[model samples]
Each structure stands twice: as structure tokens, then as C-alpha cells.
Target: MGNQTSVNRALTLINEGILSGVDSITLEQLAEKLGITSRYLRELFKTYVGASPKQYALYQQLMFAKQLLHQTTMPITEVAFAAGFNSVRRFNEAFAQELKLTPSAIRKQHAAGSMKVQANSINLKLSYRPPFNWAHMRAFYQLRAVDEMEWLGDNSYGRTITLGKVRGYFTAVHNSEQSCFDINIVFTDTDGLLQLKRIVSHIRRLLDLDADLIEVEARLSLLGNALPKINTGVRIPGVWSTFEAGCRAILGQQVSVEQAVKLLKLLTAHYGERVTVGGQEVLFFPSAEAISKAELTELKMPGLRKSALRALAVFVSECPDSDVEQWLKIKGIGPWTVNYVRLRGLSAPDCLLADDLVVKNQVLANISSDPQESELIDIIHAKDKAAIKSYYLEKSQLIGQAISPWGSYLTFQLWSQQ
Candidate 1:
């Protein structure tokens, strides 16, 4: 692994060690997966990834262990084993060896007793690679806010979302929570504590927290300070429930945000389940099953819209276990709608909803009120030939990568200007 190419190959292998799927993969199995001699792979990985494959695996487990320690009511032994260690003793030994502290010690450090869960919420910090403009980002959130479900006020953005059947609320205090963003979660179930870590991870993506800002700056250098100051890589503010996101998307079709929000509130007040918490009326996003069966035709929405919304409801109802993104297959549920839901609802880090007016304008020579699916077809519709082709080529690559890990923020930057 001395040459540049060999170094690249080994680095590729090491980077492939994603945090997911580590629980089931053993060191011996990973060696086979990398197709290198296990010992050599071990030595090279330690030199490159800064840890042996076994150690890396343990590091991943320790991260999971940390998640449990902070997010769950699980016993330390159970947290150890669930993180894939064979026993509590082994987990403690490894925790001490790698982290230089026992699992119990870490748990005590963040204990509910020691740390206050203010306003009935736990504060969490999300890390990011940044050139973030918090002022601009908050302004964007303020513009697109929905009523009751999500709102921007009191110098914070707050909303309630449904995770599967579980309902929870999050409030983002722009500066108070931690490094990039601080969010507090108030949930219905204590079991929800464990789920918060993954939710936090998704929120980071939705916000484009992990984006490589240096690369982003390079790509947008042509836009000069307009983009950097404007926050082209701003993150997508996410929703907890895909159902709520779907409803919001449906309401947003060809309408002003205020109008769309009014319609959404009408729908929720009519169909969404009501919960009483902290003296506020919190409405759960309507489930597919509920939407499918309920009489939401009361909204008097257009027939196409009614059908689309109904289709979304039935889709959500049928596959009760699948994510809302997985269940969105109604005839009118095209790329735009699904992509919107993914961006905001499912917390997809890089989905580009092509139907968005912002995305279209950002990637075009001249702005149209629309940048539809047909725009993608216009490669064949090149009437001006060379000039049009050159124009498209210049902007196309940037457009494609706009949403890769930070598209929502890109969208945020564009919309904030509006």
C-alpha cells in the first residue's frame, strides 16, 4: 500500500466502514469484504484510519454505547450488549481502554439527575463542518413556518413531528443548545430517549450540519460573497412526521406559504389527533390510516389535490411500518412531492426537489416561475444549440451537487432571498 493508488484503495476500504451494519459484521468478515490479507489490512488501516478494524469496530460500538448512555433508560449491561459487545464486563473494559472512562462514569456525566431537562426537554448539540450564517438560516425558517406544527418565534424555531406512531416535539434555539444548533425534545414515551440520537443525526443531515464547507465555498466562489454571506449550504429544516410533511407539500402546490399554511391548519384541525402538553394544543400529524379513512374532503380542496392527499393517506395507512418516503406512490405523487417530503419530512440530507422554483432559478440562465420535469427534457429541446448548451453545462454540474449533502440549506439560501 505504498503507492498513491494503493493508498487510495486502502483508504477507500477504510472509509467504507460506515457506522451502520457494523453490529453484524465481524473483523474476520470485514477482512473478506476488503479482499486483503487480514493482518495487512489491519496494519494499513491502523496507519491510515487511525485505528485497527477491530478497534474501529469497537469505536462504532462505543458510539452506540454513548447513545444509550445519554438517550436511554437501559441498564448499563444491556447497553453494552445491545451495542454488540458480548458482555457488560467486556464493554466496560473496552470503554475504559478506548475512552479512558467507564460506561457508568459517562452515563453519570449526562445523567437526568445531574443535568436538568429544562421545559421538559433535553438539550442536544449537533456538530457540523461550517461556514454557516445563523441569522440568514433563522430568517429562512421564519418564512416557511407552519402553524402549531412548526413555528418561528421568540428567537427560536419549534415544531412537533410524528415518528412512526410516536409523537414528539423539537424546539431549535439557534445559539443556545450547542455548537451549531440546540434542540430540545419532549416526547410521549420514555422509550423515545434511545431514538433521539438517531433523530439527532437525521436532524444534522436535514440541516446539512456535516457538510464540508470548504468544498462548498470553492464551488460557489463564482457567486462570490452573495452565496457565502447568503448561506448557500444552509440546511433543510426537518419534520418528525412524513405525514405532516406530505400534508405541507400538498398544501404548498402553486400557492403562497401563508395560504398553504392556512390550508394545512384547516386539515390538521379537522383530522389531526389532539394532545395536551405544557398548556398548549399539540396536534399529531395525521396517520395514513387516519387520513385514508377520515373525511378530509371538508377542506373543499381541488379534486386533484384531494386525490393526491387521499392517496398519500392511504399509502401511509397500508404500510404502517415503512417510512413515509417508502409509502409515497400515489399517481400524482411525482418526483417533486416525494423529494420535498424527503428533504423536509424524512430529513434526507441531499434530495433536490426539482419542481422547486428556487432550485430551478439557481440552476438557470433566466428565471421562470417554474422549473419543471420538462426542463430536464430540454436537453433535447436545445434550440440555440451551442450557446444554450454552454449555458446549461456551466450551471448543471453545480445544480446536481447542490443538494447532495446540503441541498435544503441551498434551498434555504435561495428562498430567504425571496
Candidate 2:
């Protein structure tokens, strides 16, 4: 752990390179990103991560596929390919060997429970990382809480999100007594369950559950006297699907929070496929393909903006294997849309959507304004400003050592505060 920065960067690189999309990298390339010889990177990974770089990459690839299989309706073969497995036969073999269940069986196990499990618990399971600050998350949502459509779940802490079109309700509880988090979301019987796993995955991402907080806290301990009131382990709220998050971002453009929520409601209600479950109305964010097939021209969108939104959806539809980079290129889409999707949809742990008007104004008001870009740029500079800040803090007692592991979490917490 001597080269904390390099090791930490390497870890993020490894995970991102594997999970960022439908591609996986070789050990040699991973070594290059860490600025180390392949042998050295292999040794470093084995020592710190308990697995060689290649093994870790394989684990990530396979596990991601496993999650998708258990959570989605996607064919096992497709999940295998998406997770970078070379062949469905190999994926089935490994999954059966490693997890004691065939990939197909895992999907069957869930599908079998379609009737026995309560409506709320059927589609997903509540996931969490250790040391989650549940109270803080509930409080954060409460402050910016929407009025009618959402309800903060009773006595216990949780937020109720009433989506458009699809009928569903999700309630999250930090089971302090159990030291585990609990989530229950029941959607009207639809194809949405196939996508629910993706939603839960993004939620885990936004909350930064993947963060290694101990390393981050160690870094923040150093900046001691000069730092602003920095908090550790703060999590960002994430949205489930990229398109769903993107649509919300579009609705939020240049409007007040209340107005944006209204627009969100209007858009979902108008374009979404409405459903009723447990006697409540819920909407599912429409897919690009679905939107492309539907008639949105008569909806209340502004003339060109309507087409712009449709174009964005169409762009994503055309590229079924869409990622953030592609979403940013569509007309009327900008840095804000991508970052919003990254934060809410993709659940990127360290992304800060300072590109938004509110966030930009907050940045300028809190820090110096060299330029509008400077405000956004500051967060990305110096191998991650939050990383730098955390490293400086953790290394306060050290002279020139690398504070390797905590930078990602540092970035996550800082962006959450902003």
C-alpha cells in the first residue's frame, strides 16, 4: 500500500474498465493505466486486492453478469456477452461451478418466486455497503422532498417515489438492528422487473456503496486545519435507468424543482404506459425504443424541445448498448444531462453535476470563479480534487507518501455535499 494513489487509481481503473460498458481489458492494458510494469501491477493487485489483476477482472465480469441474470429478463447468453464472457457455455460452466447454481437456474429461482414473494419484495432486494449513513440519506431526501406525489415512508425513514406510467412503490429502511439496508419496490406486473435490477444497481452506485470508506476517512484525517467542513462517506442519490434519469434531467432543464417535478409528472403521465397496483398510480420511465414508437408529438412539450427530447430518446434507442459518452452528443443534450444520468442513472460514485445552473451557482458562490468552466474544471483537476483534498488530509501526518485508495470515496463525498 505504499503507492496509495497509484493503487487506488489502479483499482478504479480496473473496475471501470470492466464495468463501464460492454468491454473488458487485458492485464497488460490495465498495467499501463496504473503506470506500472505488468508484473508489478499483478503483484500489487494480488497483495492488496487478494486476487491477481486478471482474476479480479474475470470476477467483476462474471459477477456483473450474475447480477443481471438474477435481476433481469435478459437471456443468459446475452448477459454473458454483456459481461465480457467469451461464450455462454463457459459462462454457464463457471457460474454453475462457482455459485453452485447454473445461470439459468438462478433466473428460474427468481421467476419461481413470482407468486410467493410479496408484491413489494418480488422484483428486487435491498443492497447496501457496510457503514451506510441511513439517517443522513433520509434527511437529505426530506429537505428537498417533493410534496404530493412522494411520501416519506412512515415512522421509519424512507422516501416514496411515485413514478409515471408504471405502477409501483419502493420503501427503503436502514435496518440498524440488523446492520443491513432493506428495500421493497413492487411494480404492477410489467416488463419493468427486467429493468428493476438495473435500477437497484444504479441506486447502489449513486449511494456510493461500492466506496471503500475506511481509506477515504484515513485521507480526510490529514487536511486537518485548512479544509472546509468536509464530510466522509456521504452518498449521492442515483436513478435506476439511464433513460429514465435522462428524461428527468430534460424535465428539470431551466425550471424550479417544483416545476420540474410537475413537468416530470406531466411527461410520464402523457407518454408513459399507466398502470395501477395496490390501488396507486405509478409510471415507468419509457425506453427510447418505446418512445420512438409512441406518439409524443401531441404531448405538451415545446415545439423543437419535443423533437429534441425525441431525438435524444431515438439516439439511445438506436444504440441499444448506449453509454454516457453517446448520450452527451445528442442535440439539446449537454454536460448536465450526461452528468445527471451518470449520477442518477449510471450511479457513478465520483461524478459531480456542477454543470447544472443550481450546482454551478453553488460552486461559484462557494469557491472562486476563474471562469464558468473553472468551477466545473476544479472538481476534475489534480487527479480528482476530492481525492487531492482527502489525500492531503490523510497524509497530514506523513511527509510524501501516496494516499492511494480513498480518492474515489473522497470524490464521492465531496460531490454529494455540493
| Global lDDT of model 2 | 0.56
lDDT of 1 by residue, 1-418 (tens): 1332233433333323333222345555555644556787777766667777666666766886786688555668656654666677788888888899888887877777333443344666555665666666576567666557666765577777555444677776665334556667777765444344445554554465655767754554544322434544455566655676787888788887878867777777777777865557777666667778876766756778878888777776766535444544576676777778777765554554545776555545322223553553474366656654565555545564643444554555566564
lDDT of 2 by residue, 302-402 (tens): 65556667787788777764556677677888886777776666554445343444443433334333354453346546447675455434433342132
> In candidate 1, which residue pairs get closer than 3 Å at backbone N, Cα or C atoms, i.e. clash?
207-235, 234-409, 235-409, 403-407
> Each model's TM-score, in the order given?
0.68, 0.57
Count clashing pairs, candidate 2: 13
Q: Among all windows of ten consecutive residues in candidate 1, which has the lowest summed lDDT? A: 13-22
